[model samples]
Every structure is written in structure tokens, then in C-alpha cells.
Target: MESLRELFKIGFGPSSSHTMGPQRAASKIKEQYPNASRFEVELYGSLALTGKGHLTDYIIKQTLGKQTIVRFKSDRLPYHPNGMKFYVYQDEEILDTITAYSIGGGTVEYEGSKLQQTKQIYPHKNLKEIIQYIEDNGISFYDYVLNYEDEHFKAYLFEVLDSMFTCVQNGLHHEGVIPGRLQLKRVAKSMYQQAINTRRESDRERLLVSSYAYAVSEENACGNKIVTAPTCGASGILPAVLFYCYKQLEIPRKELIKALAVAGLFGNVIKHNATISGADGGCQAEVGSACAMAAAAYGWILELNNSLIEYAAEMGLEHNLGLTCDPVGGYVQIPCIERNGFGALRAIDAASYAKQLGYLRKNKVSFDSIVNVMKETGKDLNSAYKETSLGGLAKEFGLKDGD
Candidate 1:
């Protein structure tokens, strides 16, 4: 597995795959051909289907300049759903062509063996191996991460956490309709206000967590800056849980940072073993993985054992299986934002369940097994449900109101 730095990318959202990945690819191509007069990009499959709503073309143009031509092709490349072919031009002559795959979480892989391998930080690639390593070393999961990661990782995580907190704060302060045809009203401020006024402690806690989640998700949907917890689409879940622990439960900042490390370790395992791209694995890969990451982090905050933490992570993904990437109108609104709120609640519930029941019964299905299942399920999902926006909620209601 690579460093947590790759897993948690800080960038302007709405999408990591559609926006961040393509933007990165375009920037790289432009740098490689600095003398090129113009650029042409052809988006394929999921990228083409939802590119307009996700601002894929907008970012590419922003990166490659106004002369860049962006085309949408429904057919997919053999490599990935979020695939693109770039053509560099100088004086109306094609200089070179490059094909790249946005393999989720803002990670891009170029064709023809162009991707350079980063040093693998962790020897263990799956949850079972990770747990065994921790058990043998008599260390916590975060310690296992620290054993492989450089000392600079602590400062990096502090920056990531700071970015997350800033996004949440910014969202809570901004109040207006989100920038989309849907005109979705920003609900985070209202929700946070309601959370502050709620009489029931339990309800207040739930509202606070959900408001934080919504705050981040809303910010992402508005093309605001946010950290990808696993992906931009699912960015809200982990921060929601961790922020709740920090503010409501009064967990120390150092402890919360440790929890972030633990969460990143689990997220790395999932990314290594399965897929975190919604276009590749449906919403399960994005939101489900984020939920699992948050659950594991919450379990760590509660000081649960490895078995219980794994249980919490497993339940988080298991319940979210078959969740489709059905963002209505190809925009990361509607189900996307609401799903983050629910995913946050579910993460907390999963950790609480593991805390209460993990001792009575061992988890039959491991987190590793669930990741495998998730990968297989993502493969089984139809292309329409895999962020193409051809089916599911996107298709059914996409043109009904003409948003």
C-alpha cells in the first residue's frame, strides 16, 4: 500500500475521479508539451456520461486553456470507466497522444507503462495481514501505520485534518443555493443551527454529526475545496465522525489525529484490495469505503480491540453493499449529499454496535472478506449504475424536471 498521502487528496471537489483526475492528467500533458498550441481531450464512459454535471470539462479547460477541445464519448476504454484520451497539438499538427485512467480518489494511471511506482509504505496489503502484524507487534493499528510511514506523515495528517475542519466551517457559514441547475439550497447552516437548538441530547448529537457531514458534502458539491476521505464524493463521512468525537465527545486533537491514521490504514487496505472509484464500483466503493473508514476510526477513538474495530469496519461496508452511484442529474447532489449524512450516522452506529455486541459474538465475515465482496459486487454492477448516469435515479428523474 502507498502512503496515506495518496489516499487522502486535498483538492477542489464535486469529484475526485471526474474532476481531480482529469485535471491532473491535463496539467501533466500540458507540462510535457509546453510548446503545444492547443489540446484535445475525449472523455469516455462514466466520464462522458456525467462529465458535464461533474465539471470534468470545466476543469480540463481551466487546466489546458480555452483552446482545449473536450469531447464526450459514450463507449468506454478497456482500462476504466473514467478514461480519457488526450491529443496535444502545435500549429494544427498533432504532436502526441496519451491515454489515462482516473482510477478513483484522484489517482491517475497513464497508458504504455508511464505510471511510476511509489515506494510501498506498508508490507501488509489486506486487513487480515494488518491485524496479524498489529497483534504480533503488540501495537495498535495507527502504530502499525506509524511503523511504516515517515515522521513527516504526522504533519501531513495535521494539514489534512485542518483542511477538513476548514471546509466544515466554511460550509456552515456559507448560506445560499448551490451552484447548479438543481438550485439545491445549502442546508448545513440551518441544520447546524437546528442542532444547536435541539432539546434532546441524542437528537442533537445526531443532528450535529449529520450537519457536519452535510456541510462538507454541500461544500464539495459547490466545487469548494475539501479533502478526499477516500474520494471527493464520499469526503464527508470520516470528517463528520471525527469532528463529532472532537467536539461532542471531547476527544483530544492528538487522539483524533491517531484515529485519522487508523482510518487511512483501513482505507489503504480497501484501495489496495478493491476499488474506491464510484465509476468503477458504484457508490459502494466511494460512500461505503468512507463509512467503513469512519467506523474504524470511531472504534479506535473508543479504544476498541482489533477484532471489534474490524467488526465495525466490516458492518459499515456490508450494509452499504449494492449502493449504486445514482447521483441524480449526474450532479453529486440529491442522493450523494444525503447519503453522506446517513453514512456518518451509520458509521457511528456501526462502531456502537461493535462496542456493545462484538464481545458476545465474533464477526463471521471479516473486513478483508467484505472488501473482496465489494470488489466482486462492483464488477457485477451494470455500467448504468456505475456512474454512467444511464440508469437508476439519474435516468428515472434526470429529465423529469429538466434540471
Candidate 2:
């Protein structure tokens, strides 16, 4: 598996696969063909279907030159849904053409090339292998992560943590409708204020956690800087949970960072064994994987056993198995933003349930089994349900470009 740094990325996001991935690809191509007079870019599948709402074309043009031409195609590449072709022209003649795929989580893969060419950091391929390694070594998840990841990874996580906090703070203070056709008014500020005024502790916790999730999700919807716990569309889950632990539970910075390591391990396992791209596996891959990661982090913070932590993570993804990536108006607002709050709440519920049920009995379903099921379920889903914005809520509410 690749490093956690690849799993957790910092960037502007309405959609990672749509905006961040295309931007990165365009920037790289711009560097390679600096003297080229113009460029042509073609977006396929989900990128084309939702490019305008997700700011894919805008980012590409911003990265390359304003003269860049972008075309949208309905056909998809067999390699991945978020696919693109770049044509470089110097004098009305093609200098080069490159095919690439944005394989989710803001990562790109060239034709016939691996998603990431960097050296593999961990030997385990799946959760089963990871569990065996943990048992054999008699080490905690934190120790296992530290053993494989270098010091630089820890420093990078700190930066990610800071960025997440900053995003939440910014969201809570800002009061305006998010930039999109939806005209959705920002609710995080009101939610947080409501949380502060609440009398009951339980309601306070719920509102606070939900507000944090909304804060980050709204920030992402507005194309602000945020960390992708796995991907931009489902970016709010883990941060909301972790921030709640830090502020509400009073957990220290070191412990939260360690929890992040454990969370990344869970997310990496899912990303390797299955998928994390909404365009590939629907919202199940994005929100589900993020919920699992957040659950694992919460379990780690609570000092749960490995089995309990795995159970919590399993439940997180299992409950969200068939969640569709049907963003209304092709923007990462509406269902996408609200789902973050629900996902964070579900993660907390999953972790707490695991901790409370620790002495009852062992869970029959392993996280690995659920991951396999999710992958198969995603394969069976229609393309319309997988980030194309052609079905579900996107279709139910008839809204258009200016509506």
C-alpha cells in the first residue's frame, strides 16, 4: 500500500476526482509543454457529466493557460470513470497526446501505469493481513503505523490536522450561501451557535459534531482548502470526529495524531482492497470509507481492543454500503453536505457501540468482508448512481444551470 500522505491530501475541493485530480494533471502537463502555443483537454464520464458544477473546467484552465480548450465526452475510459486526454499544440499541429485517469483521492494515473509509482510502505495488502501482522508482532495499531511511516509522515499529518481545524473555524465564522446553483445557505454557523446554547450535554455534543461536519463539507462545496480524509466529496467525516474528540473529549494533540495514523491505515486498506472514488464506487466508497476511518480513530482514542476497533470500522462501512453519489445539480452540496454530518454521527455511534459490546461477543463480520461486499455492490450499481448526477436526488429535483 502507499503512504498515508497520499490518502490524506490538502487542496481546494468541490470534488477531488473532478477538480483536484484534473488540476494536478493539467499543471503537470503545463510544465512539460511550456512552449506549446495551446492545449486541448477532453473530460470523460463523471468528469464531463459534472465538470461545470465541480469546477473541473475552471481549474484546468486556471492551471494551464486561458486559451486551453476543454471538451466533454459522455463515453468513459475502461480504466476509470474520471478519465481525460490532453493534446498539446504548438502551431495548429499536435505535439503530444497523453491519456490519464484521476483514480480518486486526488491521485492520477497515466495510461498503462500504476496509480502510484512510489515505493510501497507497508507489506500488508488487506485488513486480514494487517490483523495477522498485528497479532504476530503483538503491537498496537499505533505502533504498527509508526513502524512503517517515517517521521516526515507525522509532520505532514500535523499540517493536515492544522488545516482541518482552520477549515472548520473558517466555516463556522463565514455566513453566506455557498457558491453554486443550489443557492444553499450556510448552516454551520447557526448550528454551532445552537450547539453552544443547548442545555443538554447530549444535544450539545450532537449539534457540535454535526456543525463541525457541516463546516468542513460546506467549505469543500465552496471550493475552499480542505483535507481529503479519503476524497473531497466525503472530506468532512473524519475531521469532525477527531475535532470533537479534541475539543469535547479534551484529547491531547499527540493522541489525536496517533488516532489519525490508525484511521489512515483503515482507509488505506479500503482504498487498496476496494475503491475510494465516488465516480467508481458511488458514495459508498467515499462516505463509507471515511466513516470507517473515523470510527477506527475513535475506537483507538477510546483504547478499544483491535477486534472492537475492527468491528466498529466494519459497521461504519457496512451500514453505508449502497449509498449513492447523487449530488443534486452535480454539485457537492445538498445530499453530499448533509451526508457528512450523518456519517460522522454514525461513526461515533459505531465506535461507542463497539466499546460497549466488547465483553458481549465477537462480531461475525470482519472489516475485510464488508469491504469486499462494498466493492461488489459498487460494481453492480448503474453508472448514473456513481457521481454522474443522472439519477437519485439529482434527478428527482429538477434544477438547471440558472435555477
Candidate 3:
């Protein structure tokens, strides 16, 4: 039941769990050993498997200095899949050693006392508790968050929304191959231009939204500063949907901010009950959570009732269950970039469907239950499918190094 700090992290990232987390950890370790002669960082599990492509070493080097040594440990950690060990050396003597885990959604946990960093702002953690509170108090989730979280959180959210918009703008204009072996061309500009020139009205919204999602996600892939809707890998979904809501649906800026609050609440529930890391729960945790967060926000913007909002959120994750995190060549391009467009589309569809089915009690599944199932399913998945790029499309494509 930690605060929703992970919901909207503004950082440069090709991968949050891989790049941002390690850089953050390195910065922390640097603070502890400012005068150390040298530093070495060991990346474990998924972080190591994809560190080269995700620029984990590059970011760590930037934080610790050019001479910083980075070693990749393919062996999985007992604590979390994305683990890093930082060491400081002076005159051939070990000054300090630190270990940390990037537990999805840009959250880093130190070797010990990780729990000490978390604070529960809301008394309620799960959907059921919040639902009960809503039923009793007759106030919406929006009200609940406003009542519980202080003004600072709201101000932070405004900044987050502004940053999201700025990211989309930056992505749309930037073109050329992202720095990597794949040499993938930026598509947001072309997509946006194509959408604008579309002769058919039916495809306008879809095209534009996909372009927006592509913009943010492609920016993430290039290690540009972007907000992690849940995480950087799936950052595009929420922004795409929100932008569409603002431009197409004409939702006001004030209402859109409120919608963001509701979305953060939904994401916080999943982060508490399940997770939001591809390394932990495959792509289902990352993209699925983003899809659900977007759907919930859309539902709230539509003024749908609480049950319908939950239903929208649940469908988003349910439909994406078991989706593997198999980034091609360990880079967050390929399936990852296109995946954000699909996730955003699914989120929009899920929200519309939930709104259409409002008050119909024919559902057999619940949002809270789906969160549990997602975590269990993630735990049951093979390591290769969980962001190691060893299985699924990552393997079958036979482009291990994209060589």
C-alpha cells in the first residue's frame, strides 16, 4: 500500500526497471561513497539479459563516472528479477557494497529496509476496501483520493500531466533512428501526418491515438524523458488515451487532471495487490496495468459509476493476461512500441464496453480478483517469458543480437 510514486515517474528511460532503476540506485550509492576511487555495478536476471540494449550500463556509467565497471550476471536473484549490486573501491580496497532491486514501475528497493521507504497515505489499499468506503461514504474514488492525499500530490499530478503532454509533443517532432543496433525509424510524425491526411473519418481517432502512443513509447525507447504511466515500457497507453479524450472527446483540462487521479488510484491498487513490472509478471504486468489505468481514467472522465470503472479496469488486464514480455533483441522497440498502440486501443475499447454495460451485474470476475490472478500467473510463467528475451517472439524471431 505504498504511495503512487511509481504511477508517474519523470525520467530518461529506455527501460524503467533496467535503465532508470539502476541509475537511481547508482546515484544513491554515489551519495554514500562520494570519494570512492572507482565503482563497479553488477546487473542480474532480466536487467543483465537486456542491459546492453536497454542502456543499463550506459546510465550507470553516467551516474558513477566513465570508468565505472558494469558486469552482467545472468543468474536470477532470489529477491527480484531486476537486481543490481553496486560496489565502491578505493586503493584496491572495498569501501562500500550496496544491492538493490528494480521492482517494476521505476521502484527501486535497497538490500535491506526497503519497506522503510514506503508510506501508506490512504487507509484503504484494495479495491474492495475502497468500494466499501465509497458505498458507505457515498463519495467517489476521486473524492477519496482528494480527501486522503494532500495538496502536494495534486500539484505533482498537474506536473505529471503537463510532462506527459510535453513528451508527446517532443516525440512527434523528433525523427530518425533511435540509438541502437536495430535502427528503427521514428513513426510518430509520419503516423500523425497520415492521420491528419486521412480521407476517412472513422480512422482518424484511431490513427491519431496510435500516433500519440507511438510518440511517447518511441521516446521511451530512445531514452528520452517520459512519464511512466505505470512504467516506461508501457508509458504510451495512458497519455495516448488522455490526449484523445482531450482532443476528440473535448474533456477539459481540469476534468482530465481529475481523471489522472482516478487512474493513479487504479494503478496504485494493482501495484499493491499485484505488480507493474514486465520483469516480474511478463508484459501483462506492465502493458496490462497501463491499459487498465487508461481504461479506468476514461471511465471516470465519462462519469461512469464506480462498478463500471472497476469493470473497465478489470477487462483491460483480463484480456491482456499471460502476455509475455519478449522485447526483440532486448530493446524496447519492435513489439514494445507497437504493443503500446494496441494496449491503448484495447484500453479505449474496454472503457467503452464497460460504460455500455453499466449496471449489468452479469460479470463473473472482479477487478481485485484479477489482480491476484495476474500475480499468480506471472509467478507461474517461465523466466524466459518474463523480460529475459529468451522465449516467445524474442526467441522465435531468431534475432538475438539483431546482428
Q: Could you tell me every candidate's TM-score relative to the true structure?
A: 0.97, 0.97, 0.96
For model 2, state the Cα shift of residue 69 in Å.
0.3
TM-score of 1: 0.97
Native-structure RMSD, model 3: 1.7
Per-residue C-alpha lDDT of model 1 across residues 1-403, encoded as one tens digit per residue = 9999889999999999999999988888877888899998999988988888899998999999989999988599998889999988998799888999999999888888454534677787788888887888788887888888898989898999989989988988999998877888999999999999999999999999999999999999999999999999999999999889988899988889999999998899899999999999999999999999999999999889899999999999999999999778778997899999999999999999999999898889999999999999999999889987778888877542114
Better of 2 and 3 by lDDT: 2
| Candidate scoring better on TM-score of 2 and 3 | 2
Which sections of candidate 1 miss by over 4 Å?
113-119, 400-403
lDDT of each: 0.91, 0.91, 0.88
Predictions: Cα RMSD each: 1.5, 1.5, 1.7
Candidate 2 TM-score versus the reference: 0.97
For residues 25-120, write the lDDT of model 2, one tens digit per residue: 888888878899999999999998888888888899999987899999979988899999999899899988889888889988888432334467
Candidate 3 regions exceeding 4 Å error are 113-116, 401-403
lDDT of 1: 0.91
Candidate 3 residue-wise lDDT, 19-119, digit = tens: 88887778877777788999988889998888888888888999999769999886977999998887779969997777889998778888763323556
List the pairs of residues colliding in candidate 2: none
